[model samples]
Target: MANKPSPSPTWDEYVSELGRNLQRARISSGLSQEQVAYRSHLSRYTYQKLESGIARPGAPANPTLRTLVTVARILAVEVSQILPAAAPDLPEP
Candidate 1:
């Protein structure tokens, strides 16, 4: 038997958590992944990957402003609610 390859490491935990939050919000808003994808101008595969936590949310594929706005519009909630809060402090450049 051959050893299976490991899955890609998620870029960030915050993105993974955000994916969960988005899914919950979507369900609460009574919309399917496909519906959100279509309305958000994203492919179903992209949306599925996002909801499944396979893709990192708020990253390149996941952090599209269009997606956040679409989700907010569909869920009737503020974007901040679904997305993780920003760090309160940042190191100076």
Candidate 2:
């Protein structure tokens, strides 16, 4: 028997979802990207890019985990809620 591959989301869908998550957090906290950037020690442009889904790899490119933690703190939410979960690999039969 052969294992079937699961369909993954399209690139655009992935980008849009990430962007939506960022915007939702920002809006829920009544904060602008600029405010989050300042508090997180990230540039406004970088934060904006993240919110716009212009940042490549469909995720924020913050080098350090501390940077994401800072942003999560500013949003008053768990980092896991914002970051994408890892997809399980297809089984090899």
User: Best-fitting candidate, measured by TM-score?
Assistant: 1
Over 4 Å off, model 2? 1-6, 10-12, 56-64, 85-93
For candidate 1, the 10 contiguous residues with the lowest summed lDDT are: 84-93
- Expressed as tens digits, the lDDT of each residue in 23-88 for candidate 1 is 999899899989988888878898877776666444433467877877688778888888765432
**Considering every candidate listed, which one attains the maximal lDDT?**
1
Per residue, candidate 2 scores C-alpha lDDT tens digits across 1-93 of 899865665545554566678789999999988899999888998888767766665453333467667778899998777765533233467
lDDT of each: 0.73, 0.71
- Model 1 alpha-carbon drift over 4 Å, by segment: 1-11, 56-61, 86-93
